[model samples]
Target: MGERAQQIPFYCDGSYLCEPCAELCRTKVQRQKPVKTKAYKFNYQCQCKFMRGGCKLRYQGEEGVVLSEEERSKQKEDYKKYLNEKLLMMAAREVPLNRLNQQQFEFSLESNLENAMLYDDEITRAVALSCIPPEIVDLASNPVQQLKELVNWFKFEFFSWCDKPPCPSCKSDQAVERVGSDTPNAEDREYHASQVEKYLCKNCKTTVRFPRYNHPMKLFETRTGRCGEWANAFTCLCIALGHDARKVLDWTDHVWTEVYLAQWERWVHIDACEPLFDKPLTYEKGWGKELTYCIAFSSKEMVDVSKRYVVDPVLNRMRRDRVNEKWLADTLQQRREALWSMQGDSQAQFLRKRYQIEQGHLDAGSAHKFPSEPFQPRQSGAQ
Candidate 1:
């Protein structure tokens, strides 16, 4: 039977075979694989390969009601609004501890550093250095001077500020103004944006959606936003430049960065938007912005660094009513302990010692002290 298998009339059109041959054919037919069918999505509707000729099998399921584009959009908007309300209600009741956990986890991975280095190519750095002063280059060994050069290079040469998105048609910033805000679209959400700001171009009457992308890689291309984008991009660059950097988020509508200068053995403020280095009290003392909470997020830890900025801790304490003071303190301590435990013994000891030193400075009300430098204007021309 093995040698004769090739001679068997398996594909005979209508030929009749004897009983044994017929049984073999039947067995072969029974063992044969079924033909495979494919399915795909087209115009938000499922199409089955078997019923390719005007298939209506999709109507048999919950997708029976084919919604109009307008109806679908309305449904999406309603759902987003409902979710936002729920989130606000939840935030009112409790501290958003998950924000710290999720954000710090992203930082802890140091994914931003690699992405930043990849995005900020050597070509770009070379171009930036060409414009930097020779004095700054000579003082490259000094961490303070190194940071100043980096900030100046980043702000003046690398990135631009966007108070309002420029008109795509006319390419004019003067005519583009914010009209409204909405939830981020699928593409925007893919890049990790919380909101999409809609701007109207007066020249062309065109509406543009500006998604505030948190990802540093995306910001490298856009290179124009408020403090959030500047801080996000610059913090990553600081890490790439071999400085211990962390993103600082001010709850009272501002953002910046903190870099731990080993020579100084303390974290100093560096706002790329301001292009300012070691200016911790600029917001409170210079800009007169009421500071409540400033949280610094790094790869190893999430710290409540509000004391570093707030000129009056007594008054700032009154503004920090989002969570019970004891609860917030306990939560921060637990997070620090959890993060520190993940490190090697030496690293954990270093972090604990640093934390103690920072706390001592905060206690002594000397955390805001910054070296005197000539008053420098905001290089970004940000209002």
Candidate 2:
């Protein structure tokens, strides 16, 4: 019976200990170990999959593969050598001969203008005419005439004051008086200053002041303005006329205009604020040259004369102001030298490579896998 009972399985009958096999069976199940995964890394050279490309290259670590201090030092030295070689090559390159040709052309043109045997009118006409294309001769005799037509058109269209009939808005019948005409011999500076203070805008009938310290703000308030305002307005107008003009900034950052003269093949300075017809008079006290004023388009002679009166503030600054071109060049050279020295240092190269690795530059296949430290096992629960 006992042998049969052992062969047969026993059943539980509402008791703490059920069948013998059931009491012998283990309740706690062991957990399966987690599968390990491969880590990814980056490679700097020939970036490709190692297995597919038949590359067995391994990254020891960021510290091991990174450029060493010695290597960096050598690289820097090589960089300096490369820079010097490049600089020498640049020095060997010849400047184009055409540069001298341009300078010579400009010099000759300037000389011809200064010492020309022709009368001022003839010279101006010739230069102005030369600016016009041969195809356009039938339409206009010269550039000057074309410019006059353009100015007339501008005056008629944009500047209502240029229209032959006075504008109805400004009561154009009121005589347009040239301010400083009555005081021809008076001090120009004092006279111009006074006129600016008393001047009023014809359009808005607003009082305008020639800012003593800065460029005029309300330059376009009227059909006309004081000499300073006129100069700026004319400069802006010339730009609107499809002419290249820039405001000149001088020692005091004094404002003026430079106009491209097609005939002269260069920029010419002009001040419209000064009377167009006035000739500069020399002061016995050496207070500088006196400015003469003239009417706009008084004559071709007036335009030619005005050309001589213009000055370049930049040229004047270069001549009179202090500059340190050599010092600047030397400082730049020193900085280049320092950079080269650092690049050639092996230590720097090593540090740079390490930095790149820390910044994730290594390849995925060769990346290091760290082992986690074992944790303390818990004691068996109290019975």
Instruction: Estimate the TM-score of every prediction.
Output: 0.62, 0.24
Span of ten consecutive residues with least summed lDDT in model 1: 40-49
lDDT of each: 0.64, 0.31
Error of 2 at 38 (Å): 84
lDDT of 1: 0.64
Off by over 4 Å in 1: 1-140, 369-383
Maximum-TM-score candidate? 1
- State the lDDT of candidate 1 residue by residue for 171-278, as single tens digits: 787888888997788888766686799989888898988888877767777877888788887877666555778887787678888989888888888888876777
How far in Å is the alpha carbon of 185 misplaced in model 1?
2.9
Each prediction's total of clashing residue pairs, residues at least 3 apart in sequence or on different chains, is 0, 36
